[model samples]
Target: MESRELAYFVAVAEELHFGRAAERLGIAQPPLSRAIQRLERRLGVTLLDRANRRIVLTAAGEVLLSEGRKALTALRSAELRARRAGRADPRLVVVMKPGGDAGLLERVLARYAEHPDAMEVEVMICGIGEQEGLLRDGHADLAMLRIPHDDPTGFATEELLTEREVVVLRRDHPLAGRTSVRMADLAGENFPRWSEECPASGQVVRDTGQVAQMIALGQAIAVLPESVTLTLRRDLAVVPVIDGNLTTLLLAWSEESRSRPLAAFVRTAAEVAAQARPAEIGA
Candidate 1:
């Protein structure tokens, strides 16, 4: 069907309420309801299961919701690529969280610069869990992401480095002096939550910097990749979390990206990762 129909279906499927979906789409409930009815009629299937005070997607609706999202992503990517093609000097936009690239970002940039055909590189530091969305929607040509923290599905990724996890705590905390600790040791401690969209247990904070501040004030602790320890303030103590999941760093790009500069940058990143020492990279 049309993009607008897909958009309407997606909105209603996600919200499960016509009034709420209409509000989100900046329209009134009746028109939104009509659009869904029209879509169902065209497809000759019941898309939604409607009952007293309840709404749920039918099997058909589920399929449309999944495929519609992919279609929208593809459409957006096409528009962005077309717009970028008209620019005088093409640049590859790389998105990542601040200080999230292990220690390979600078080395990768320097190595890529040596290539005569390399395009200008623009680094966009974004919030936690935002890298994937940026790359998917064509806001970025590439992104540096860590496993478990960022999902890399639907994109091609190159593994850069893997590092041990560390827990950042206040210097005066009971577990601060330990050489290493297990996850169970900090079970009851306050862990600062990063994003409301993906809620984690314990107290909530905006970003790692805020997590650090909270730790310094004895408000909360954080379990993060070892690389993050390099930026921690002196008042914080970092202890290895022996049983925590290892964080794997990856360079991710949309499967649709075919730019020569983008390909060159990916090659440089892999080469740099291969030669770099894990300790030096994490430090």
Candidate 2:
């Protein structure tokens, strides 16, 4: 019913650990538990199933979590509309894949900073699955994703860049000095496979964290987006994949988002991509 209650529910649902949720919300565990209890009482439904050492959401909790996020998104849009009408200010929401190109976003912000209207751009790190959901549910105006989206009927997509896959290895590895590497060369190498929940999972990786750890330990080779590999551990050497294909990074949004600040962002991204000259582009 209240925004604070919704916030508490979301926090707990995300963490699933009472103490951790409390810590994340900047409160003690007792009050957090009490708040959950109150929320359950108010809704007349059990939201969580708690065991000795674990907590899991009930079906009711799952429904609430989904609807609550939609409600919160609508609230944000309402606030933005009010702000725009009163002060000629605009706001844009963008969800990005983790370890994405911050430099590119920075360029867009710098280029659009001189606009007459006051504007705010909110950026959040989200998974690939969440990106399209966020936009369709009105929580976000745009998203940057690792894989190319196949469906583009009601949405517009701009090919920002294609990032080469690179082999990440420890400096001590024998293959570190190679000008380029191949996946087969690391056949026996314990690749960093991404978890099924990870964005890169099932794409070209085995396990994301595990592979990263192996690469860090010089036990196996891991192939990752050049942008991501470069941004991660500097101790790891990243060499282009001589025969590997690249992942296409794209900017996508619904057509309805075109009239809002999202349009400005679309244009800014195009300009920034041209100026940055990231990797290669295809027709």
After superposition, candidate 2 runs with Cα above 4 Å error: 1-90, 127-129, 148-154, 195-214, 218-220, 279-283
* Overall local distance difference test of candidate 1: 0.87
Per residue, candidate 2 scores C-alpha lDDT tens digits across 1-283 of: 8988898898899889888888998999998899999999999999999977788999999999888886776677666545644655446778775555534777677776665542688787775346666665566667776663323445688877776688888987888889987777766666533445544322334224445666777666667676654355767787888887777777888654536456777777887787664542111
TM-score of each: 0.90, 0.59
Question: Residue 121 of model 1: what lDDT?
Answer: 95
- Candidate 2 total steric clashes: 7
lDDT tens digits, residues 66-133, model 1? 99999998899879967976789878899998778887888889889998779899999998778988
35 Cα displacement, candidate 1 (Å):
3.4
